[model samples]
Target: MDEDSDAQVMLRVAAGDRKAFALLFDRYHASVARFAYRFVGDRARAEELTQDIFVKLYRNAKAYKPTAQFKTFLFRVATNHCLNEVRRGEYRVTRSTSSPADEDEKGVEAVDAQAERPDEAVAGRELERAVGEALQGMSERERAAFTMCRFEGMAYRDIATALEASEAAVKSLIHRATLAVARKVEALQAGIGPERSRA
Candidate 1:
């Protein structure tokens, strides 16, 4: 089967095409999950948030249009849904990252080792933990702007469009977010090991 452009898929979806809907789901579900995970710093909430975005898409498929990139439309919907959720204060969803009892019994060292390269795993875990903590520390707009720009690699114009802010404003959001996150990461690295410090 020929791969359809997202806009084409949406056009089909709007016409009640189940296959196109399935294709969109298959294409974006993971990205949505990761986007949520990066924002909320909780895997479970990330999963829920991702599902919620797709739900909105499914419900609104009839309204789909092709004036912009399909991802741009998808992100616009996703960003708005997340922002509304933030406003409703419903994201206080609670979950835990504590290791399962079975996993813990295996070995703390085994759990700590996450990278394929044995030598890199310990540092990688620490870095990931630090970044996760930093993400939790950010404001909603900062996190959204930062996540879209840094994680998704969206252009400034697209981000400004998605966010409905000026390019300058978008840049400011990303800059402030980067500075704040970088400071937290630097502080964390400083507290680790002298040999571990890259800067």
Candidate 2:
């Protein structure tokens, strides 16, 4: 279903059709749910928030404008909803994703990083933990920037559009986030408190 462009589905959805909404939901629900769970750990809350966003999409479909990329619009909706609900204490803050699939992914990345020395598995897990802790400590905007720009490999311009910030501001934010995360990882590796490191 992802093969279908969001704009095309959105156009149909905007015309008082439910099939388009169904297709969009099926196409996006997993990713949105995963993203929500990554941003907020509670499974129930993530499901609730993801559903609410889709509902909002349906209710607001008539106002859809195709001028912007659909991703930016969708994420903007998710981000704003997550931030607002977070502020309202409706969801629990969580670490980065830690699914069974993610464990397999680390195994794959590890294979690529050092397939010759598989004994580094423990060290790799430790490093992954350090990174996850660092990500967990970031502000929502910083997390969003770090996740979208680095983890998701989005361009700075796209990130700026998704985040609704100037490109320079987005760049600075990502730079700062990366630096903070690196410092945290270094502190963890060195067995030192993160407070003593550059942030």
Candidate 3:
């Protein structure tokens, strides 16, 4: 079925349809988990968060409104949960440590940094680390906007709906986030070049 059909299933779920809820979960579980992983940067925690999100959805299904798309509502719930976790310091500890080499990192590679040689591969990894650090430094809203826009390829209007912000505000958040990440990456690369020159 087409994605828009998920909203119909959600409406059925609102009316106490167990099968509909299962269908909804099956349709979105992976996407939600991936989004949570991007926000939290921990696979286990992301899985937990995804489970929590689905549980919340089940409980709140009666409140579902078709005023917007179902995906928008789902992301809105996910974003709020992630931001709360961030505020509660659940993710802060992980953010302090460097991201380990993981399969999940492949999903967050919004930039296509082709590295043909061994040195370039090392540089690519360093650049990815620097970008991850910069992301950790972003404010919750900025990070959310950047993730949705860059990693998820969400449109600004959809992001604004999920974030409850104006489209202009979302644009500004993403632009500022991009500039901040770029500056941090350049600084990191500058430091790396000097060390390499000395070697």
Q: Assess each prediction's global lDDT (C-alpha) against the native.
A: 0.67, 0.69, 0.78
Candidate 3's TM-score reads 0.78
Per-residue accuracy of model 3 over 82-178 as CA lDDT, tens digit each: 8888788766524434344564254445666668998977767766666666676678899889988887778999999999999999999999999
Task: Name the lDDT of candidate 3.
Answer: 0.78
Model 3 stretches astray by more than 4 angstroms: 93-106, 113-124, 185-199
Task: Name the top lDDT candidate.
Answer: 3
User: How do the predictions measure up, each by TM-score?
Assistant: 0.77, 0.75, 0.78
Error of 3 at 122 (Å): 4.1
Better of 1 and 2 by TM-score: 1
Instruction: Assess the local accuracy of residue 53 in candidate 3 as a C-alpha lDDT between 0 and 100.
Output: 96
Backbone clashes under 3 angstroms, per model: 0, 0, 0
Looking at candidate 1, the ten consecutive residues that score lowest on lDDT are 102-111
Per-prediction RMSD in angstroms? 6.2, 4.4, 3.9
lDDT of 1 at 171: 92
Position 11, candidate 2: lDDT = 79
Better of 1 and 2 by lDDT: 2
What tens digits encode model 2's per-residue C-alpha lDDT throughout 1-199?
Answer: 3323888789799998899899889887876775666567677778998999998888888777887666666777877777777777756565444664564442322112242455565555555555656666778788777777765556788778878899998888888878776777678568674445434
Best by TM-score: 3
Q: Give the candidate order by descending TM-score.
A: 3, 1, 2
Q: Between prediction 2 and prediction 3, which has the larger TM-score?
A: 3
